[model samples]
Target: MTASHILLVDDDVELTELLADYLTTEGLEISVANSAEQALALLAPPARFDLAVFDIMMPGMSGLELLQQVRPSNPIPVIMLTGKGGDIDRILGLEMGADDYLSKPCNPRELLARIRAVLRRMQTPPSAPDTRVIQHWGLALQLAKRTLLFRDTPLELTSAEFNVITQFMQNPGVVLSKAKLTERVLHRELTAYDRAIDVHVSRVRQKLSKVLPEQELIKTVRGEGYLFIGEE
Candidate 1:
């Protein structure tokens, strides 16, 4: 199998180097950029990268800014590297289309796990020999293409949002606990107060609501989890 290429962007040269070395040892190909500008240049057309790890406190063009600019045209999965206590930055990064976030000075092992999780959510599965689309209650999921359409209108969703909605579509009315959702959608166990899954589900709901304004599609089961009210 081909190695997954990663773009690591941060102003901290030493950290990027250490991470590159560690990630390489862990079976992922790493590319380093010391600034958001350099990272943008590397993202130019025909230069492929499976995922990006951006530092939110970069010298110029913060990771949030980079995401705001890139999300309009590029759909690459991004994971933000944030300093502890920057809750605002983490939330804004997700709103701007980041796939995940990791606190700075994090264990290399944890970062590796987060990266693998994001890749699992972003990577499209192989086309089934028998079927490629799953449809229920006016929502059509093009599994092979990883796109969702409602009433023939396509929904613009980030990779993470698409994965969350796909899980909902697959289960229909099944009530999925937050822990179960986190494990299924993020490919990791849920941590205390970890709101990543909730944020992604909210984004999906917002997009779905915009297209289907008459009714609520994903309902929160207070104190339990989320339920997708769709026909099986």
Candidate 2:
């Protein structure tokens, strides 16, 4: 299993250190940052931060601010750490794209639970049901293998990108809205600010273009979502 690299951002010295030690022991690679500016600066180079754990009360720039600025460009998952009894902050944190929220007096085990849950949802298996296949152009989809093939040549796809393509190919020419795509791929309800699906769609299109450059396989519908274009 691939270990997740988590960015720990907080202004509290003792708490950050303690959390870092505990999370590191749990087989996660951790990078610590004291504030949002520092965290954003660290996120610039290398670009290997898989997730971020942010404290909502940091000085200079708040955790929510950091997310607002970066969420437009970065797709890194985030879990916000809020002060205990601050329900309003917690609600706002989630609204602002925080994947999950942890309270200050949170139990180590509880935080671990939320972390694993979020990661699990993000990494859910895409084992397609047996006895199903969708063919477009000269491309074939192996439902079991979760692989796309053009003339039996396998195509590499990112997890999210693969999920979206799988859904579209399974029901070719079916117009799937953002909500439907999100539910299928992310396994969650769609929010207006949900751009994750769009990112995955862009990536899937790129891969398809590389293999099927002669035509646009996935057609975009005006005022709608997308469709896999091919004769039934």
Candidate 3:
């Protein structure tokens, strides 16, 4: 098995070094970047990083800025490291297409768990039999390719957004609670005040709306959850 490669971008050299050593020992290939500029250089074409861990508060190019710059072309899963209680940063990171996030000064073990979860979500099982493309309301989700096409026009979605829409489309009209969606999409139990799932769902809606103006594909059920309104 080829070890998953990770790019760790943070201005905290000591922390990056420590994390690199720890994650390396845990069967991951780690590349440390002390700044966002360095991270970009490493992320250039031909670079194959399975995932990225970015610190949100770095000087110069903040992690959010870096994410904005990279997300347009790069689909690599990103996990943002935010300051403790930085709910705003957390939401912003997700809105900017980060796959997951963690509060800073966190346990390395927890980061590892998040990394593994994101990587798992990104993987397609070789022996899996479900390769059929899911088409609903003119939108086609190619399961095997992990791509979406609306009216034969491709939609660029982040990994997290793709997973969210997959859940919605797979169970159309089902009011999937935040807890359920979090479990399925994020591979974790939802915590109180956690808005990660909401942001991802919102992003999916926004993208779909661009190609689906005048139609609301996903409906928010107040006091409940969200439901994908499939073909009637």
Number of the predicted model whose TM-score against the real structure is largest: 3
lDDT of 1: 0.87
lDDT for 42 (candidate 1):
96
What is the lDDT for 133 in model 1?
A: 84
TM-score of each: 0.93, 0.56, 0.95
Please, what are the lDDT tens digits per residue for candidate 2 over residues 1-232?
7788888898888877888889889998888999899998999956777778888888899988898887746767787787766667766665555665667766777666666656765653557446556688887888766678889898866445567788988888789998888777666667654455665677778778987788788888877898888765
| Distance from true location, Cα of 110 in model 2, Å | 1.5
Lowest lDDT sum, 10 consecutive residues, model 1, at 123-132
Superior by TM-score: candidate 1 or candidate 3: 3
Ten contiguous residues with the weakest lDDT in model 3: 124-133
Which runs of model 3 end up more than 4 angstroms from their true locations?
none
lDDT for each residue of candidate 3 in 176-214, tens digit (9 for 90 to 100): 999999999999889888899999999999999898888
Per-candidate RMSD, Å = 1.8, 8.1, 1.3
Q: Ranking under lDDT, best-scoring first?
A: 3, 1, 2
Per model, how many backbone clashes are there?
Answer: 0, 0, 0
Arrange candidates by TM-score, highest first: which order?
3, 1, 2
